[model samples]
Target chain A: MSSKKIKAQMRVFQELENQLLIQADKLGVKDDYNPIKIKEMEYDALKNHLLSFYSERSNIEYEMQVLGTDKKEVLIKLEKLEIYIKRAERLLDMYKKYFGKVFKTQNEEKEKIEKFLTKSRISVSVGEN
Target chain B: MAYEAPTIAANLSQDKMFSAQKAAYQKLKEEVPKEKQNEGTQQMSSLVWETVEGKDGSKTYKVGMQDTVYLAAASSALAEDEVESLSKNNNLRFRDKTLQVLKNKMVKLAMDTFSHNFFVAELSKMGVGVITFQMGLLGISPAEIEKLMSKAREEKNIAVKNGLAQVASEKALFGIVTGAKIV
Candidate 1:
């Protein structure tokens, strides 16, 4: 691909990143309760968005390889996408643990509920028997 | 007379051997047909032809490379064509996969932002209702508690509506930027 095209594509990704950052900032300011947490969540969401693109690009690369038709331009594009994705991931990680504690808490709560429901079901089954 | 040692090996033999090798190389070059010679020259103007001796004492002409980048460029062009054809054949697959991933991400974003906000709003309403009830029980005027509850409810409702609007706007922004529908 031409350098101009690559630059244009990079600008698009940058624009997306800017939009996400602006939204995150807005969420932080608006959140009277846990502004930092909300902002971090927004950042994480954006990172995941980029990650999805990274994954899709990877799939494209694999597909291209399988077809025995690797394109230098496509590979370059994927590499560029990876760089942005990594940067986003790093930035989010630097601020917080990057989707660890939040997911852990949610999972823990879910597990607890599941265990409680299982116990209740077992007890009810025993009573019926 | 000064080389009294009588040079152990006469240089004549070495020269004769070199002459023979040169003759053999010339002969081999001649054996290569005129058409083949012209074809090699046409393909690579700066081609360096060399005679290589095998273990069996057979000589063969080998072409050597001078500085050239055309071959690399040609191979790259060929590779590009192959990739273009493959991409064209599987264009639909690629499009489907891209759209599928995009849709999935959109759905996840909706769940993460919109549903979570809605859930929080609902929980806030419930919490406010409980607080008002408790305040009423604690000898606060029932009418005052009711009024506070109504105000809190209204605020929560507006917040929920705002959250929904924000999510809708976000979706619209994504659609505008990417030129793709959220679905």
Candidate 2:
């Protein structure tokens, strides 16, 4: 490719990358009283943010290869992003597991109490009749 | 006239000479191991002497330590009187060649410094760009982002100032190396 064309393409890629980052900055979790719900929202936002980063990184890598430039700088940024993404993922997983267990236990307890109440009401109706 | 050895050396006692030599040897012993570890690397060693040929076909021995404290004793021994006499002498080709080598080294060093600072400044700017992208992913506050961006700008400004100073020095050194007459 001609140098001028490559330069122009690089400029477009940079602008697109900037837009993606701005979109990510604008991402916010909805206000919720439930901590689990808040975390879930955060996880979704983070997942989308990570997707943007991955796409942007791939685009940069492809362009760098085409332009015959060194990939060291891009690789460094990717490495740092990877570390943060992994930590975020770990936290998300922990919250999911903890909340999932709590909800399961609560549902089981609720079901047992409802069954006992139903049996008691049937016995009371029969006595009244 | 030949460059006469400075008479200051004659005043030094045997004990002082021995002590100086001992100290130099001790320093060499300490530093040689560090240099050995850097062996096979691209780093230049000050202990190594280089020979530069003059335009007049005279050879001069120069070492990187000429600007360092390792040569303090030798530089002190050169004495201002001997240096002035050498400069005034008709057959001072060696002294002129040495001066030329020093000037060349200074110009080269200034150029290197300028390029290094410029590169670092560019890298700092790039780092800020990357961090701006990361702030969104990491959910950093606007206030924090403002602080970080300002700090990055400050760092880049300092590096640019340093680079400009080096460029000015490089120009002056280049003029000296080329024997340009200063007004």
lDDT of 1 by residue, B148-180 (tens): 434433443455445534543453334334433
Error in Å for residue B80 of model 1: 55
Q: Is the docking of candidate 2 incorrect, acceptable, medium or high quality?
A: incorrect
- lDDT per residue (tens digit) for residues A4-72 in model 2: 655565465445433323222222111221345433444455455557657777776776688866668
Give Cα distance to truth, residue A33, candidate 2, Å: 2.5
Query: What C-alpha lDDT, on a 0 to 100 scale, does residue B38 get in candidate 1?
Result: 69
Winning candidate number (DockQ): 1
Evaluate residue A51 in candidate 2 and report its C-alpha lDDT on the 0 to 100 scale.
Answer: 71
| Angstrom error at residue B109, model 1 | 28
Model 1 misplaced stretches (Cα beyond 4 Å): A1-32, A97-129, B1-183
Candidate 2: clashing residue pairs, number: 0
